[model samples]
Target: MPATIRDVAKAAGVTIGTVSRALNNYSDVNCHTRERILRVAQELGYRPNQMARSLSSKHSKNIALVLSGFLEDTMLNDFETMLMKGIYQFAFEHGIDIAMYVINSRTQKEKSYEQLCYEHNIAGAILFGLKTNDPYCEALAASHRPCVTIDTEVRGPCISNVTLDDVTAFDELTQYLIDRGHRKIVLVHGRKNAMVSMERLVGAYQAFTRNGLTLTHDSIIYTNFLREEAVAGVGAYFRTHTPDSATAFLCMSDMLAIGTIEALKSLGYRVPDDYSVVGYDGLEVANYTDPKITTVDQNIKEKGYEAAHLLYDMLNGIRPAQKLVLPHTLVERESVKNLNELSN
Candidate 1:
């Protein structure tokens, strides 16, 4: 027979109410006592029936993780894989199950979100790819349901969010290039509607202005973060402008950088020797490039881990912060070269 709460209480030498409080992570429970109860429960292999617990506590025992679009995009797919791995690992340990939802413009308008929530009986949600002006965000807030956004912003009511300091990171990266004596820099940005893309573009411009440099409209190009798009965009930009026009390229993602690098090689442009490149997202593939990409490491796996843990806390009645910002670092690699030395 499966171990019961009463059995755990007896094993821990605590009252049933005390066991309940400890299991629920109530603040009133003594830390030591709670630890003891947890230890005892583990020793006896006590697995709480999530369904029964939900029925008793008026919770749905289901949480939703919503992505921005379909899994066709390589960058998004990679992020989803890493994020889901972390989320599932944490959820498994905590006896929670995740219901994943992929929301696009079509689904958002087709009653899919509501149908998903109802079908899964989700008590809370974790949303990714929230646009700045997303109307669904407002509806989720108005519903008074606990939700968290990953790599996006959620405002008003009981919503929480986690994102990187994208602007600061981009600024620091661009400044690093400038400090290394790169005067002519090109930017390959992602979708315009993405908050991250807008912030990064703003940071790039700000970095140039702060250093008494000017950015022409032709200095920046936009792509949909697709490999083919990256290749075509960079190739087209270079075809129109001379190699001396820009000494370096700052890509919004490593995948884009890979595409740009391939395009450059096809045009007889040697990386770092003729042009330097930097990318964001320190994916494993970044290192595999001919000259390993210099990038901003956002620790994607950790982001997912933190998101899952935050949701778990919210489910247990712990009110976490409204906004969580993860830290990022610059990974210097061979792809970025000092233009001053090359010029000499």
Candidate 2:
């Protein structure tokens, strides 16, 4: 038989109410006492009654991790791996259970978000891969449930979001190329629906505008963050424009950069030596590449960690709906060659 709360309370020499308060993370409970109660409860195998807790104080200790449209065939990349690690780290430390709720446009049409959350026993959600321009985001904004999105921008009464400042980071990154005297640049961008991609495009535009350069329609290649798409897009772009028509490729993702490098190699060209290249998302693989990638280190893991924190804060009313932008750094490496005539 499972130990009751009363049994654990007795073992810890605390009142039943005190045990309850500690378990619920009430501010009034002493930290030491709370730790003792938790230890005692664990020792006795005390499991809180979920149904009863939900009825009395609303949904308790359960969150839904929302994922949509991630690549199913490939292994998880370093950015994704670290992001989830950070989120689970917080959940484990807080004793909160996580349930994955993967949905897409079709699923939303079949069942409403509220119904889905109810069926999953979800108290709150950390959402990923949502689009700002999609209709579902409008519904999410109106739902007023605690939802935190990663990289997607959806504003609502109860929505909190966490992402890096894409505009500034990408602006600085694009400018990095121009400063090195790269006038002929090709922008390898992402899908039109994603707001991050749109914002990053804005950053690129700003850099081009300030430098009296232009991102012509013909020079932009669109991909869906797929390496294969990057390869095809780059290949197709070069077919229309001569190999020397562009001196550099600025990619929106490291995966795309890796693919771009592969595409270049297939064409008898070398990175930096022939056409300079750079990428975003400072993945570990970026460093291990033959010549390390010049990319934006956007602190991807911290984005997930803070997404968890924002949702937790909203759930507990510690803070209202918040938007947190973590810091980003431009890591320049061997993937780019200085074309500014500073060559020895």
lDDT of each: 0.79, 0.83
Best by lDDT: 2
**Predicted candidate 1 versus true structure: per-residue lDDT over 168-266, tens digit per residue:** 999988998998899899888887788889888888889999999998888888887777788999889977997789989989888888888998898
In candidate 2, what are the lDDT values of residues 1-344, reduced to their tens digit?
77898998999999999998777667788866875786687568566787345443334446888877655415466777778888988888887767776677666555556545544556689988776655468768877578898989788888888999999999999999999989999999977888889999999999999999999999998998878888999899878888779999999989889989999988889998999999999998999997799999998877888888889888998989978889999998999888988654
At residue 146, what lDDT does model 1 achieve? 77
Clash tally, candidates in order: 0, 0
Worst 10 residues of 2 by lDDT: 51-60
Badly placed stretches (over 4 Å) of model 2 are 1-61, 71-75, 342-344
In model 1, residue pairs whose N, Cα or C atoms come closer than 3 Å (at least 3 residues apart or on different chains), thus clashing, are none
Query: Candidate 1: TM-score?
Result: 0.79
